[model samples]
Target: MSLLTRLLERNLRNSGAGARRLYSNHAEEESSATKHEFADEEPVQPPRHQKMATDQDWSAVWPGPRTFQPSVVPLPLRQGYTEKGAPPPSKFANAELMKIPNFLHLTPPAIRQQCEALKKFCTPWPKGLETLENCEKRFPIEIKSTDYCHALPTIRNPEARRVTLNIKLSDLKFDAHAKDKFLRLVGDRYNPNTGILTIVADRCPLRKQNYDYAMYLLTACYHESFVTESWESSKSEADMEYYSFERNKSKQSAEAIINWGQPVEEAKKLNADHGFAQSVEQLINEGENVYNLGKYKEEVLKLLNISK
Candidate 1:
């Protein structure tokens, strides 16, 4: 447009070109200086694991439980969270592998060696207590307990305090009155068929204290059962909760029906019929089960001489 404006535009283009040519030498010098600084430095080499010899003892290498060491372990282990379709990372200093404990010391050979070393500290088994029958005969009372372990803040478990004491009812010698009182005191803890009396104690906070409490209860029950009160002596057959026909009027009535018009002494002398009556009494006392009732009917017919 104007002569001055045209001249300024041409000079600006020439100045840019001249500036590039002038800085070319400076840029090369700076680049050369950077190259010289790093030229003597070599590329870093990765850490290498020492190759183990074939005859090396593994027990000495890994003596106890410890974090997994990829450098020490001979196997090529791989661990780490991988994205879908991607392979897991190799086990060289892997965090996932190091976090968990290793059971390298628990090899079969190591375990056998440990057992042999500890054998001197162990006591030999009692000679005569090999059989279960002999063990039961010697130790009549059986004590049962439980233990629990958890990875929690507190190590104590409430259930570990409970203790159970079991003894046979037959082992506790008692008269009829004492036995009845003892059974009443124990309530449902007594298993009549198995004749086992189980006593449980858990009030105390410790296992040993609870065990001692259970033994004390058993001792108290036994001593209290033998001490007959005035009211206990006055208890009659009518007051009995469970029926025993032999000790009741039912046995006499059945005997009279089978031996009518015979002398009381002669009826008592009838051993065959008397045994049948006793069997029938037992069946009745045990409740009217179908098989037992049938057996009872057969015994009754035989006693009465009733033919088909």
Candidate 2:
């Protein structure tokens, strides 16, 4: 708007115009130089191709899904058990046992309670049972019994003795039990009559019911040891036709030897019941030693004991 200001402004514009024109010319020169350089260079042969002479290595190829190994691995085989304690058969007895007739075995004692009748029948052999007369110890016979009840007082004669049974013989289930009872009773040497039959018949081991007649009959069979008359028969004396006295005596001896081994009187002792015998021998030796040492004048008479 003022004259001097206009004159200063015109001089600034004219000076700035030369600077701007110079910068513009410099930019143009740089672009031209790049263009000329590009034009002078030959275009690159599109890139040299390489034909790979070796196989492509895929050793490092990674698996798509990651997996983990089991902590408890699978096994081709596993472990278990065997039957170790099976029993061996050889040690046991499988023998076919001798069986008795059912009538003889299973019958209630009422049927077999005939000790008196059997004694009556066996009466023909006063020396002993006729059938068993020629044989070893006669097995006491029990026959088909009748239900006759009677009282027999206990006998204490030396030849005849009486003992009570733990269980009644007639009440046994069968001949096996009867035989066991008989053997045990007869086995005693202290006495022959250690068997007793009871009307009490209780304590019968097999069925436990009492057989009064059976008990009495077994008692009578046990009585056979003493009452010779109970077994002695007028008939037996008459029937000497079947057996002779000399023959009977020989038979008795043979039977005794066969059944009881020359009587218990002939059995050898295991050794006289030495009892305190060894203790006395030891005391004597000990006393002798003390005397040899001259320790006492009396010579230890404790074993010899002289004073009254």
Candidate 3:
């Protein structure tokens, strides 16, 4: 059975009986009138354990008045920050690391470290995708298993049967004049689920240097079934699209960032511009100038799509 199917069946079985109450509330009896402060007792007694209907002995504890404590929180504290432990802001102030050519030069440990980061990003797969024979059909890019498996996997635990992606830095696309310099992966690992292989760069050298991208892949799946299965200290949410774009930032509505939270719009704009639209724009702007030229003139220009 699929893990999802198994989970649903397990939930259904537990729902019928013997499960802890899905929601529990404690009610306290309220007094109609506040009693006046009593004279101090001749001997202050040490607090005693209070045992009542539930039959478990408990040490006396107090927060708000026992009666005032609500049977349930007045409003769910949901969506408010519980805790966000991020590296200190200064840790990211150093953006000059990219000044070094081949910013992703990796030692053996570094490569292993990056592979581990990739696995962590892919986590919440629980057992890690088990069946991979059919995965490459789904993602937009293809990822074949690589020969580097013996040296890779999450650094925490390198497995012999693990998937490997051994792309060279030279294969990544970059333009010295362009603001966006991401090296998108044709990542080499296949996800066992959905049978679709997708490319997510094994290492965004910039992320390690605290330089984020503005145009990126769409990888976040929050409120997902596997959210609980994060395998590393970083949650699976870390796998979400990360775009640190310069141009698109000004167009962002407040909600596009703080609310929707992924780089969806920015990434769309980016890939659109670079992959296809830029060529179209170049053709549109230069066509008239090129057409009015001498030898390669009217007939050639007419035959070209400039007329179409």
Candidate 4:
């Protein structure tokens, strides 16, 4: 073979290798540029809360009490403890804040809207139940309720077993003796100021049992109050827990003073003064006070027709 021919072949092979290397470099550059362009054209996802507009209705986002949601809320809130001088972590992806309950769904407008929506399922107010007095007269019994929240496996509150029953003492018909007996039987559960009887029964573990027990207690007291035991009739005025001037020397003395040296008819007329008798009794039992003395003096003057 000729040397020149061999050298030309070597040169041709070297040029081809150089061309391939140049082509490979150009293709790699083109591929890298295409990737950069595609990356620039891709859509950017902004923070979820940033999408919320100022004019957006919060009621639509949350309609009731629920777990806290950070993404949907537009507020720039932060939570979790930090160093003394450091700010708290941002609300986004904040486990400490999200784990707690939120009142976002309980906004005034949301509550109003929820109530309006629920109104369609409610019944109209009953007739003749206009005033609170009228309602109380119709339904004197009041039942109490309670709610509880827990972070346990089961949602049970021990206090939920407690049941309260209240009713006006006036609602139950009773004579003076029966009423006194009922008051004594109920002990401190009866409120003299409000004339209400409050019965609380927590002896049972279940609420229904406790409620039933309270009802039984009330019924038993009412029935037992009317029973006239032989010992009850034998009780004298001195044996009474409280003072009663009616069966004492005070009533007779007061009547005698008001009807002094008068005939039977006049005495009967004077004795018929119930207001005077009541005022005199109250004054005697309650002891001396300016108001009581004034009231007693007024009653005595009215009964005897004396001018001061």
Candidate 5:
């Protein structure tokens, strides 16, 4: 071989060896970098509930209202419906559990603690208003309203705006004419059995407004009841709401039969038969029911001194 060709071959061999060495070093560096990256990475942690102690204060952990967290709660709660054979969905990553309200903070012990804390701000009951009867006497008017909490965009409930006012008719001082007029004005709103006049007001949008409206209605009815119209005086016995024996022709007939051929003073005394008057009034007013009719028959026989 020529000297120049030999020299070129030797140089090519040296370059090939250097290239192999550089490639080996680069591969070793890449492998070491990959190993270091893996060593620096953190391991995945277990759930928070697994780390929590069994006797831990749950109220402190879940203080106040919040969306449910599966990892934070210790209980194995499950929700959401599944197929007939399948079990309900687990608490982990459950949309059903997260969507609804959680009462975790309102545990019995927590409630007792809260109530104790609030006791200092409360006032003792008034001395005379201990009994329900005394309370009703002291506060004749009873106002009722409702409050609601919902997971809705708007907190205002339409039904909550309605206000109800209840008061016994007897609580108000009313004469015969005024009482009758008040009953007529209230119609069926006044329960005869309970004697409770219920005034429900929902015409206004706000609760306060509805409450004011109900009070206004009650006051208006009360004042209007005492006002005697000219037409009311003209109401004859036949036009009376209830039968009154004294105001009916039956009174005169009974007096005539009882005091036949007697003097005026004797007739007046004989006319004062309370049993006969009561029987007549009841039979007419109560629509002649079997019991009332029997009572009337007995009273009539007694009044006329006739045997059954």
Candidate 6:
């Protein structure tokens, strides 16, 4: 080979050798640095749960709500579905367990501790409100509402805004006219079987606003029921909703029949019997039922002294 060609080949070989040695040195330095860095650190200990005693205070460890962590909880809890008859996935690295809310903080001991801490803020029960009947009598109005908690962006629930007010119709002080008007105004809202009037208000956005709206509706209905319209005075016996013995012609007919063969003083003394009036009213109002007919016959016989 020529001298220039030989020299060029030697220089190429030297450069290639130098590049290979530089790469090898870099790789060895990196490996040694990594080993030294790790060796300076202590070895990772086992999970905290492995060292925990059986009687450790769980409340102190998990004081409030949190996501499930397998390393923290010592229990051998398992979750998730598997095919081929395989057992459920263990708690370690479990996505299913972490997705759900954990009640680990609400252990019996934790609940007792919380209750004991809150005991100083509570008051004793009132003396007279022992029985449910007594409570109802003292506080007739009952208000109902609901609260919700879930994993959501917003804490407020739309259904929680609804407020319900329940009160017995009998609890209100109503005269005959006011009671009739109240029943007519409330319609199906008032239950005849239980005498409970339920008012549900949900138009407002907040619970307190809805509660106030319900109370306003009740107050308006009550006051409106007591108002006497001018046209109500013109309601004649023919326009009456139910049969009334005192307001009907049956009262006059019975009185005339009872006073037929008696003197003025004796006729005055023989007013229509209260029982006879009630029976006649029931017989007419309840139609020709067998019970009503039987009661009417008994009352008539008693009134005329024919059973003697």
lDDT of 2 by residue, 1-308 (tens): 69999999999999899999999999999999999999999975531112222332211121122221122112122222325785432211212111111121222343344454477666354564456433323443323212322222432232222223343344433343235434445454223254433232324432223344455655654544443343435555344323232233533443344445333554541221122233333343455565344433232232223452
Residues 170-274 of candidate 5 have per-residue lDDT tens digits of 999998889988999999999999989999999999999999999999999999999998998898877889987877788888878888888778435576388
TM-score to true structure, per model: 0.62, 0.15, 0.15, 0.72, 0.77, 0.74
**Which residue pairs show collisions in model 6?**
none
Local distance difference test values of all predictions, in order: 0.82, 0.39, 0.33, 0.83, 0.90, 0.90
Backbone clash total for model 1 is 0
> Of the pair 1 and 4, which is ahead by TM-score?
4
Q: Please report how far candidate 1 places residue 45 from its true position, in Å.
A: 14
lDDT of 3: 0.33
Q: Over all chains combined, what TM-score does candidate 4 have?
A: 0.72
lDDT per residue (tens digit) for residues 87-179 in model 6: 889999899899877789999999999999999999999999999999999999999999987657676889999999999998999987888
Candidate No. with top TM-score: 5
Better of 2 and 4 by TM-score: 4
* Residue pairs in collision within model 3: 116-154, 135-195, 135-196, 135-197, 213-243, 213-244, 214-243, 214-244, 214-245
Supply candidate 6's per-residue lDDT for 236. Answer: 94
Model 2 lDDT-worst window of ten: 94-103
- The sequence of per-residue lDDT tens digits that candidate 3 reaches over residues 1-308 is 69999999888988965443533211111221222223333566532322233432221222122221212222211221224785332212233321222212344555565688699668475343455633322222333332222222332332222332322233333343221112223233333344333433334333222112211331221112123333434634334333222233322442243334355565453222232223333343345455334323433343232563
Ten-residue region with minimum lDDT total, candidate 5: 263-272
Candidate 1 C-alpha lDDT tens digits along 138-166: 88999999987654557689999999999
TM-score of 1: 0.62
Off by over 4 Å in 2: 46-308
Better of 1 and 2 by lDDT: 1
Candidate 4 per-residue lDDT over residues 156-260, each given as its tens digit:
788888999999999999987888899999999998899889998888988989989888999999999999999978887878766555667777887778678
